[model samples]
Target: MNVSLQIRDVPGEVRDAIAALAAANGQSMQGYLLELVRREARVARNRTLFDRLAGKRVRGLVVDDIVTTIRRGRDDPDRADPDVA
Candidate 1:
């Protein structure tokens, strides 16, 4: 389900600028505004996720070190597996 949104008392210059941008992009004002809202929502969600992850530590598991180890194994398949023994 979707709800309607209404904004009141937009200044003329701002409205005209947005209208012009919408027209230039071959979209109706509604379509352009809807895309803006959706993009902003995605950005907000990403920000919230990053905020939740901030300052949390995983002991002895550096991401760069892991990637390097994987790459080394891929590049040299004859290398002994550290976890095998």
Candidate 2:
């Protein structure tokens, strides 16, 4: 399925900038804008999925505990590999 989209009252400078970008990429304005819309939709979908997953919790695991462990690993010289120097 396909549909048409229309944008009303786009400023001249904004339109010109998009036109320049399309030309630089050897694409028509329609093709460039379509790609932009598709990419944004993908990002939005991924963000929604991430938000859903972030709301779930695992037993015996906490975000602050993970952060503290990571900080300790970085700050503790005794924890560093002796051969890395």
Candidate 3:
């Protein structure tokens, strides 16, 4: 199911700007606004999700610093085992 929104009393300049942008992108004004809205929503969802995953013991990263620090009981090559035990 889909519904439409009505934004009233918008300034002429704002409407014109939206029209121009939509034209530049070869989309209708509705498509332009929907795309912008969808993009923002995706970012919001990612932030909320990653925030929830934020703190448990994690592995230290290499390369461009992506992975978090290593949790205990994980054998990393950098840490040598004692007596090969």
> lDDT values of the candidates?
0.93, 0.95, 0.83
> Candidate 1: worst 10 consecutive residues by lDDT?
51-60
Best of the candidates, TM-score: 1
lDDT of 3 by residue, 1-85 (tens): 7778789999999999999999999999999999998899899999998888886547674744443344433556677778797
Question: Using alpha carbons, what is the TM-score of model 1?
Answer: 0.70
**Models sorted by lDDT, best on top:** 2, 1, 3
Off by over 4 Å in 3: 57-85
Candidate 2 local lDDT, 1-85, one digit each (tens): 9999999999999999999999999999999999999999999999999999888856788889999999998889788676787
**Most lDDT-accurate candidate:** 2
User: How does model 1 fare in lDDT?
Assistant: 0.93
Residue-wise lDDT of candidate 1 within 1-85, one digit each (tens)? Answer: 8989999999999999999999999999999999999999999999998888875756789889999988988789788777897
Candidate 2 TM-score, true structure as reference: 0.66
Select the stronger candidate by TM-score from 2 and 3: 2
| Candidate 3 vs. true structure, TM-score | 0.61
In model 1, which residue pairs have backbone atoms overlapping below 3 Å? none
- Ten contiguous residues with the weakest lDDT in model 2: 76-85
